[model samples]
Target chain A: EDKVVQSPLSLVVHEGDTVTLNCSYEVTNFRSLLWYKQEKKAPTFLFMLTSSGIEKKSGRLSSILDKKELFSILNITATQTGDSAVYLCAVNLSSNTGKLIFGQGTTLQVKP
Target chain B: SAVISQKPSRDICQRGTSLTIQCQVDSQVTMMFWYRQQPGQSLTLIATANQGSEATYESGFVIDKFPISRPNLTFSTLTVSNMSPEDSSIYLCSVGQGTYEQYFGPGTRLTVT
Candidate 1:
């Protein structure tokens, strides 16, 4: 079956620390991998990686995809309390149905 | 990016009752979906609302329990029927702009007493 697995279910770190969140998937016909940041309300889109080895970055946040390994990693540099949220990774199938298989997610708590 | 909104941001209802959550997108989207998130859990796709057609439900989710409506491309609704305490969850509506991107609404928090 198609499934996405994220490592380090939960993590606590002090402000300014760097943390890496991992996501691995096993699915038929891989298309793209997406990352989302979910807080109290809803999840917000973070990054979508379709190619391997190329890193997508925004400010202190960056992500890379490794299709050969069927995994992805999200890195946050100099984390802040505002960065505390559940990071979700989802795999979009090549079927083009827009159906996403999501990971359990990694909860990051940045303490000040 | 598409802007999405949902009504009844949070509500508490008694068991056996039902609730319908509304999702509206600022732009016409190609696909819309309903998802459920239990506390501290990952989001699970409930169904895909197809415009002018019957919604396609996922495994473990039935139409009788969670009927969906997609009257148009910009709007959809999901009804949680015969609610129980176990049904209490955060219901989210998401819109697919194209092949790779999907945006989520604010979500409705439902509590069954």
Candidate 2:
């Protein structure tokens, strides 16, 4: 079975601090790793990483994948109170099945 | 990008009752997926609803318990039958264009008592 593990299940940081969330996976036929931000309801797409050493970024958030190590990291710099939410990491297997195996999300709280 | 809408934002049901959640996408998508998120947990895929085909369920999920119907490319429904307290969860629907990522709908929060 494909499995994903995320570290530091919960974190609290002051405003403007930087935080890093980690995700490691053991998936057969790996394809891509994805990051999402969930506030209350729906989760919004943040980044998708396909190759090693390649970084994908949007605003204050950036992510990178290490295919050789089967791991990924999401970094949030200059965090604001609005950045408080659960950050989810998921992996898509290469089977074209449209299935995603997700890790238990990291809950982040940014306090001003 | 597709905008998906789900009906009955939340409901509190008694045990043994059933709830049918509806999902509609603003734009046509080739694939729709259903997932469950228990409190303080990660999301688990329930099934993949394909247009004009039977929904493909994941391991530990059965079609009889969570019946799904996808008549076209933009719409689908998931019905949780014979609900128990364990069935209480947040159900979310998602749509994709066969790409690497998917857009999600506002989830339906169900609480079975």
Candidate 3:
């Protein structure tokens, strides 16, 4: 069975804190891993990591993938209250396939 | 970038009543997908909708219970039949962009009582 597991299901941190979220997947034909942020509505795209050891960054958020280890990590630097949301990690098993195995998201709460 | 939209942003319905959610894409897409997110759970793929063909459902999801239609490249609909409290979820529509990225619609939140 293909599965994606995320560690630290929920976290609360004061503003300016740095947090690391982990995602590990056990699936066949791993194509890429995607990260998303969900607030009150649907998730918004963050970063997609396909190459191991290479980091994808945008603003205060960044992510890296390890194909050999079958895991990935998302790091948020100097978190703000606006950054409080559920961070989702999804694994795509095939190319151009819309089917993605998603991990139970990490609930991040940034306190001011 | 492909833009997707879903009708009825949020709805409250009674159990056993059915509701059909509509999805529209701004551009022509070969692949469209439907996903369900239960309260406090991750998204689950319900089915895959392709233009000019029947939707392919994922494991544990049946066509009769959750019927889907893709009449054209940019439009699709998903109907949840015989709704129950367990059926209440956030239904999302997604479309493929190029070979790697997929864009999501603003999901329809369904609450059954």
Candidate 4:
């Protein structure tokens, strides 16, 4: 079965602190890894990483994928209360069907 | 990126009742999918709504329980039949814009009493 696992199921941190969320996957015909942030409703797209060593960044958030290691990491710097949300990791297989295997997600709480 | 929206953002219903959720996309998409997210659980693909054809359901999901209709490339609907307390979940509609990146709608929150 295709599985995506995330570490630190839940985390609490103070504002201004940096946090790192981890995602590891085991699937066949790997294609790309994506990160999303869910506040109270829909999940907003964050990053899509397909290459190793290279990092994709957006403002204070960044992510990287290590295909060989079958893992990825998302980093948030100088976090604020608004950054509190459930971070989801999903792996897209090469199956032309465009199916996504998602992780259980990491719930992050940034307190002021 | 495509903008997606869903109707009946949240609904509270009694057991044995049914609900139909609608999904609309700003742009025509080739692929539309329905997913279910149980409380505190990850999202699971329910089926692939194929335009002009019967939907392809995922394992553990049946058409009789969750019938889907894709009338066009930009619109789709999922009907949950004979609902039960265990059927309470958040149903999300996502569209694939010719890539692996799928954009999701706000989702329909269902609560069965």
Candidate 5:
């Protein structure tokens, strides 16, 4: 079955801690891998990785994809309490442009 | 990126009642989708609202229960019929931005009593 798996379901860290979230997928064919941060009711878009090795960075958040290995990782540097949220990884299938297969997500708790 | 908006950000409705959530996009989009997120669970695709046609539902979802309509490229609506406690979830609408990304709305938090 096509699925996206995220590692370290939950994590607790103090401010300034760096964390790496893993996402591995087993899908027939996919177009891209995406990351989002859910702080409350809405999830904010983080990064979209379509190419391998090339890391996409915004502020302290960065993500990279390994298409050959069928995995991706999201790294957060210098985390803060404001970064406490569920970080979700999703695979955008190549066959379907409107659907997203989401992982269980990693709950990151940043303590002050 | 599309700016999506959903109506009735949060609502508490009694069991068996039905609620319709509207989604509007800033520009015309080719694909509009509806998703449901249960408490403590990840998001699940409910259906894809096709413009000028019947919505396509995902596995385990039915049209009679979750009817969707896309009257135009920039707007869509999802109606949850005969709501149950299990139906209480965050209903979100997203528009396909370009070919790889989907921009989501604020979402409607539905509570069933």
Candidate 6:
């Protein structure tokens, strides 16, 4: 069965702290790993990592995938209250359906 | 990325009533998907709406309970029939526009009492 798992289901940190959210998956054939951020509304796309070891960054957020380990990590630096949201990870299988297998997501609470 | 919109951002419905959510994409897409997210839970794919074929539903979801219609490439609707408190959740519509990424709508928050 294809499944995705995220670690540290929930976390809390003060402003300016750094956090790493982890996601691991097991699928038939891997195509890409993606990250999303969800607040009160729908989820917004964050990062899409197709290659291993290469880090993708946007502002204070960065993510990297490790294909050998079948896992990915999302790192947030200088976290702020505005950064409080559930971080989700999903895998795009190579089978061409565009169907995504998503992780449970990690809730991050950044306090000032 | 395609821009998607959903109608009735939030609604309060009585038990046994039915509600239909509409999803519209700015650009034409071949495959659109509907998902449900309960409070504090991950998203669960309800069905994949194909333009010319019946929607393919996932486990624990059925066409009778959640009927989907994809009349065209850019428009789709999902109707939650026989609503219950258990059905209270956020329903999101997403489109895969020939890419690995999907663009999501604002989602409709349904509260059944």
Tell me the DockQ of each model, to 2 decimals: 0.80, 0.77, 0.77, 0.73, 0.75, 0.71
TM-score of 3: 0.97
Off by over 4 Å in 2: none
Q: Write the per-residue lDDT of candidate 1 for residues A1-112, one digit (tens) a residue.
A: 9999999999999999999999999999888999999988699999999999999999999999999999999999999999999999999886557899999999999999
**Model 5 local distance difference test score:** 0.92
lDDT of 3 by residue, A10-111 (tens): 999999999999999999888889998999768888988888999998988989999988999999999999999999999888885658889999999999
Q: Pick the candidate with the highest DockQ.
A: 1
Clashing pairs in 3: none
Q: If both were scored by TM-score, which would come out higher, candidate 3 or candidate 6?
A: 3
Error of 6 at A59 (Å): 1.1
Q: How does candidate 6 score on lDDT?
A: 0.92
User: How well does candidate 6 match the true structure in TM-score terms?
Assistant: 0.96
Segments in model 5 whose C-alpha atoms lie over 4 Å from true places = none
User: In model 4 chain B, which range of ten residues has the least summed lDDT?
Assistant: B94-103
> For model 4 chain A, where is the 10-residue window of minimal lDDT?
A92-101
The positional error of residue A43 in candidate 6, measured at the CA in angstroms, is 0.2
Q: How many residue pairs clash in each candidate at the backbone level? A: 0, 0, 0, 0, 0, 0
Candidate 4: CAPRI quality band: medium
lDDT of 2 at A71: 95
Runs in model 6 deviating more than 4 A are none
Docking class of 6: medium
For candidate 6, the TM-score of chain A alone versus the native chain A is: 0.97
lDDT-best of 3 and 4: 4
What is the per-residue lDDT of model 4 for residues B25-110, given as tens digits with 9 covering 90 to 100?
99999999999999999889999999999998989999999999999999999999999999999999999865568889999999
